[model samples]
Target chain A: MKEERKKIILILLISIFMLSFCLLPVIYMVIISLSKNPDFLSAEKTLRFTLKNYFDVLSVRSLHFTDYLKNSIAVSTISAALSVFIAALAAYSITRLNLPGKVILLFFVLVVSMFPQISLVGWLFKLMAELGWINTYPALILPYIGWILPLSLWILVSYFSQLPKELDKQALIDGCSRWQILFKVLFPVALPGLFSTFLLAFIFAFNEFMFALMLTADHKARTIPVGIALFQGLHGEIPWGNIMSAATIATLPVIILTIVFQKRIVQGLTRGAVKG
Target chain B: MLPKGTEKSKELIEAYSFISPLLLFILLFIFVPVVGTIVTSWFKATTFLSEKFIFFENYRLLFKDVNFWQSAQFTFLFILVSVPIELFLGILFALVLNCTIPLRGLLRVCVLIPWAIPAAISARIWELIYNYNYGLLNFLFMKLGIIPKPINWLGTSLGAFFSLIIADVWKTTSFVAIILLAGLQVIPEELYAQAQVDRADFLQRFYRVTLPLLKPAIIVVLLFRTIDALRVFDLIYVITSGGPGGTTTSLSLYAYKYFVGGDFGYGSALSVILFLIAFFMSIVYVKLAGFSKEIA
Candidate 1:
């Protein structure tokens, strides 16, 4: 009985430790963002809390906080939607149709997805510059779609494979053509899978920084992560309050979406990885 | 119900039509740039001069570059130190979360939060956490009598490296745990039951049964994390910018410097080396996991 009790106590303690480790840095960010002092390190003795930092960051004209947010949304949303759309067609073909070289196609997608953005960013910059598309939405969107489509395809393929084939047979017997069966039958059935894949792609594009940093030159096209990282002084004095506040706001949408769709994302992740 | 010959040909055409859009985009964007990196590495070209292809010269120059060696060494060191630590912590958390714990759902949700936030944002939070004077770390250390003077976390060589590692571990260990947890959940209870019947303890069961069963997941996570650690860029860029006299500059950051400085040939050579490392690691991972059959 004593040993069992001890085991339980140990488990509880470890759980508490892990929980705190996962959460403390984020909590500290929130605290520092709200703290009255602009310099977080100097305000230890009598800490004051206020929302002035939030107001200051949101109101700054040069920071372009809203512009960063708008651009981030536009880039992530369009790329995610396009990647998912393209991936859905490919995935349906790979999973349902009897196509030659299907296995090689899946393997190719897997391999391509692993290429680091650094490997491609140089040529990408030169190409974009040549095309006069630098700092444009397509500058980021095209690469983002190319990079994210493979993973999205993998997830949707795994999902579409698991769906029962009886539904396809029934639709075919009812005189549905191939396109009609895909659009009217499989697409609706795979909606949940599509939603989850879209969310994952959106998160990946939203968090992408290297490409965003290299391609975007101005506030008109800069995404949130790069914007926040470069949100320092013209004369070299770091603005801790504004930086923290911007980070907090920037991270909010991603966190909410993740928590809300955590189950679907996990399912998609495992279905793609474990089977392969 | 199987289609005859003519119908099968029609279906193949339809499938090709469905896939063509993605195929065209990937070829133009991904495959072209990939080939361009390799092809551009041979030439030392500038906008002012007509391009000249000098074979192996760029690679020869990179072989003599000191910054290249330092960044490569540190990138390898980072993978060596952080991946094992993350794997250990991840398994422990996965074990606990897999058990019947109170507030299990809440803990799972909380753990995923760190990974959900953008890497840049997480680095920002950790930068403040490692602050010297009014930072929480120093305050806690002082209260506990661990040290008298505050440490400048990102201002020194060793301090900056460890700070980057700690920040990375904090943000990414949860991802390892989530993947391992999925592995743990799929493990059959029958094996553990049999071990218990044979009078095996928890540690013994873990060693004898759990480890063997969890090999595939472990291999996959290791591959993903190591490749990711080798290409460490965003965290360093945001937190330290590979500072303190470039003590913490990673391979990617080094390449970025040359690329931005318009030394395209040298930068392409560096990128090519990084690509080779990534390629080697993926081959090893797929071989270990016996994934070739799935493709063939």
Candidate 2:
């Protein structure tokens, strides 16, 4: 009985350690975000709290916090939607139709996915400049879609392949056209896969920083990650309070999306990774 | 849906139509840029705007560049140190998470929270933690009487390097844990039970049964992580900006600087080298995983 009790205590201690290790930075950010004093140490000693930093970050004219938030949302959502649509069409054609070189094509996707964006960004910058797309939504959105399409394709292809083939036969016998069967039959049944792919893509695009940073010059197209990283205080001071508040706000959407779609996200991510 | 009597050309056309949008985008955005990087690496830029075909000069310059060599060396050192540490921590966490415990679901979610947040944001949060004056580390250390003065975590070369690793490990170790946990679930309980029937202890059974089975998963995690770590940029860019006298600049960061300097030729060469390293590493991982499978 004593041995069992000791084992339980040890496990509990380790669990607590792991939990704190994972959560302390975020907890610290939250504390600093809500503190009245900019100095976290001072604030901890005093035990005072306020929401002023949040308000200031949102309302300050030069901060451009709202613009950053809007740009992040718009770029993430549109790119995710575009990637899902384009990738789903390709996945369907590969898995359902009699396409040649499917393996080579999938391999191509994997290789391209692994290609570092640092190499690609130079040419991308030149292209966007030629098209006069600097500081425009398409500049960032196009690259994001291209970057994330492989992941979405892999997830949707695996999901689609697992689906029963009998449904397709039935739809064909029902005299539905190819597009009709795809749009009306397979799509509705594949909503969960589609939804999961969308979530994963959205989170990735939202989290992407390098392309957003390099591609955009002003607040017009800057994302939350780049904006929050580059957040400047008047007179070139680092405003810890406002920075923490903005960081907290920047993280909220991805966190909430993750929690809400936890299972599907895990499944989509792992299924592609392990199986591939 | 193409009808039972459809010609092969018609079916091929249908498939082509379905795949054209993504194929076109990838060809334009991904493939073209890759080819461009390779081609541009062979040329020399006379000015920022003009270039000349100077085969092998960029590669030669990159090979001789002291900063590029240092960045490459540091990147390898970072990977060699960090990946193993991450794997060890990940396995421990996965082992704990695999056990039947209270609040298991909640713990899993909490562990994921770190990985879910963007690296840029996480780096910023850690920057606060590492602040010399009013940071959490300094405060906690001072409270515990560990040091007379607070340590400047990102203000020294050694401190900055390890600080970047700590932030990265914190953000990414959970992903490794998750992948390993998925691998753990596939491990049948009967193997453990069988080992127990022979009066084997926990460690003995772990060595005898668990490690061998988890090899493939470990390889997958290692490959993904090593490649990802090799190309790490934003974390370093945000945390130290490769500072403390340029001690933490990674290969990607080095490439990015040249890209920003309008020296596209050298930047492309640097990135090409980075890609080659990652590609070779993946091949090594694949061979290792395959060899282990044969032994098993």
Candidate 3:
């Protein structure tokens, strides 16, 4: 009983530490966003709550916060949906069809995923410039599809492999073509896997920085990460209140997705990174 | 039913078509660009200057550049310092998380929040927290009497390095934890029960059973974190911008500077070097993990 009590206390203490460690910066961001002055933590200042920061971040036209947010959502959505679809088809081929060198293809894709983004950005910049696609949605979206495809492929392949071959055989006996069997049969059964893959891919695409930084020149294609990173004041000083509010707004979608689909996200992550 | 030869050929054609779109995207965007970067590195590619062939010149110049060496050193040190700490904290969190604790779901959601949000955004928060005058660190330290004055977190070489490390660890430890937790979950309960029956204590069971079982997962996290850390651009780019006389400039940021300056030749060379380092690490990881056997 004493040992069990000690163990419980230890776990509780670690849990508290973990919570505070993970949450303090986020909490500070929210508090600063709400405060009238970002210097509220200093001795000379006191906390004065206000919604004006959020108001300005949303309404101020010059800041172009809304434009960046909209672009991020659209680009991430398209990229995630497209990549997940492509990955699903490829996964179906690898898992169901008689694809040669399946292991080699998977391993090659894994290595491709590990290639540093910087190594690709220089030529991509020149290529986009040549194609006159810089500062457009396609500039970001196309690379994002390629960038996110490997993980999506890996996760879906694992998920699809678990499923019984009888399902495919049954659909084949029902006179469905390969495409129909995939779209009509496999997709419905793999909806949860597909959804989680989409979620992770969306987060990956949305959180992307280097490519978005290089490819997008302005709010026309700039995502939230780049926007928040480059948020500045009209004058010489840093506008902490506005930046924090923008960050808070930026983090909401991902946070909500994380909290609500926590289990699905965990499952997808492990499946991608660990075979077990 | 098994297909006849003609039908088998048709099935093969269909499978190739299914995977073609993926192959096309990856080849065009990832493979071709990496090749382009390598080819460009052997030239004098720049915006203002006319493009010219200058094989090995950019790399030769890189070998003699002081800033390049500084950034390369910083990148290596960052990986060495950060990956281990992240792994340690991650294991602790994973162990706590894996236990039958109350509010486990909430704890997990909290942990995932850090990993979920963009590192660039989180670095902005860290930048504010490290502020000298009104930043949370200064305020808290002063209140607790931990220091007599505010430390310039991002204004000095050592200070900026540690600041980036702390922020990177905060953003990534959750990722490491989650991966390690997956490893922890797979450990059979029967082994622990047997250990307990043999008069083992908690720490003893961990050392004898858990550590050995978790080795592969630990190695996976190690290599993953190392490769990710090797390309440490976003956090440092946001927080310090490699300040204090370029003390914290990562290899990626260094290469980015050259690119921004229209020195694509040198920039591509720098990136190629980073790519090779990461490539070498991934090769080591693949061999160590024995992924071939797993996939087979």
Candidate 4:
């Protein structure tokens, strides 16, 4: 009994230690947010909690987080919807269609999926510049679709392929066209797969920093990630409180989405990863 | 008039049609641009857009560039430092979680919280924690009487490296853990139970049973992580931006600098080298994951 008690204490201590390492950083951010000491630069010691930073960050006339939030939502939703649809179509074709070069194309998608966003940022920047698309939603939306297509396709392909081929063939035998069969039969079955991939892709695009940083110079096209990064108060030093507030607020969408579709999203990501 | 066994051609065409939309965009965005990047690497670009072809001078100059070498070395070092350590932590955690315990679900949720939090956001969070004044690390050090003064966590090379590693390990260790956990789930519990009946102790059972079963999962996690870590960008970009005078400038950041800074030729050469290096290492890991199955 004494040995068992010792074992239990050891486990409790180690788990607490591990949890502290994980928890402290975020907890510290919250602490910094509430503290009134703006002179964190000077390294002073005064602890006062105030609502001033939250108000400043939230006020439309001040930080305009409300407008930025609206824009981010608009871009993220539209891009996510369009990208998922395109990826679904592509994935179906790759998995179900007995087309030429399927192996080669699948391989191609794998290789392309690994292409760093930085590579395209340079040329895409130039492309957008020439197309008069600087500071435009389409500039971001189109590339986001292109960028995320591989992940979506890969996920849906694995899920779609796992679906019994007989379901497809049976629908075809019932005088249904291939496209109709896809919409009515396979689509419903693969809905979870599609939804999960979309969530994954959307979160990534939403959280994306580099392209949003380079391509969008103005609030019209700015994402929350970029907006939060370039937060300036017409002063030199960064406002830790406001930055923390914004950072906290920015993660809400991802958190909400994760809750809404947590089951499918986690499964989809793990499944997608396993296939590769 | 088609010959018998022409069903192969027929099926192939259908496959092409199915994959056409994905293929079309891939060609336009990925394949073409990659080819352009490669071709563009050979050119003497007085301009970012100027296509006039040059010789191997770009590659020649790339080898001589000290910044390139420094960044490459640092990038490689970062992967070397972080990957094995994180993998070990991941496996250890996974092993703990694999045991039938009360509140396993709660612990699993706890494990995921760190990885789920954005790396950049968490890095900022840690920066606050690593503050020379009232920072957790410094405060703890002071309490322990380890140091008389707060060490500048982000102001020095080794300090920044350790900080960055902590953040990376915090944010990504869960990813490895999840994968290993999957492998652990796939393991037969019977094996452990049987070994216990044979009077095996913890160490003996672990070595005789658990570890051999963990091999495939470990390899999978290792391969995935090595690739991901090799392409380390956002975490580094957010926290340090290869700071403390380029001490942490990774290969990806180096590639980003040259490529976006309009030294496309040099950047392309570097990116190609980066791709080759990552690809080679990925192949090594895949093989290490027991390619004997494939051979058989």
By DockQ, rank the candidates, best first: 3, 1, 2, 4
lDDT of 2: 0.86
lDDT of 1 by residue, B1-296 (tens): 55598888988899899888888778778888978988889999554566689989999989999999999988998899889989999998888889987788778888888888889888877777777766677777777889787888789989899999998998889888888899999999998999978987778899999999898999988898898898889999988998889989999999988888887788888999998898788667656756545431
lDDT of 1 at A176: 96
Q: Which 10 consecutive residues of model 2 chain A have the lowest summed lDDT? A: A38-47
lDDT of 2 by residue, B38-154 (tens): 888888752356788888899999889999988998899899988998999899889888989999988888888888898888989998899888888888888889987889999
DockQ computed for model 1 against the true two-chain complex using alpha carbons = 0.63
TM-score of each: 0.96, 0.95, 0.99, 0.90
Model 4: CA > 4 A from native? A1-11, A38-46, A61-64, B1-14, B46-52, B282-296
Of the true interface contacts, the fraction found in model 1 is 0.57
A102, model 3: CA deviation in Å? Answer: 0.9
- What would the TM-score be for candidate 1 when compared with the true structure? 0.96
Colliding residue pairs in candidate 1 = A41-B134
Ranked candidates, highest lDDT first: 3, 2, 1, 4
DockQ of each: 0.63, 0.55, 0.81, 0.38
lDDT of candidate 4 over A1-276, digit per residue (tens): 665477566567756766776566666666667768744433455677887777777885557676666777888788778778888887777667755555556555655666656556666766788899988998888777777787787777778878888898888778786678779998898887777887888776776667777788777888777777667666886677887877777765675566566556656666555445
Cα error, residue B209 of model 3, in Å, equals 0.8
How much DockQ does model 3 earn? 0.81
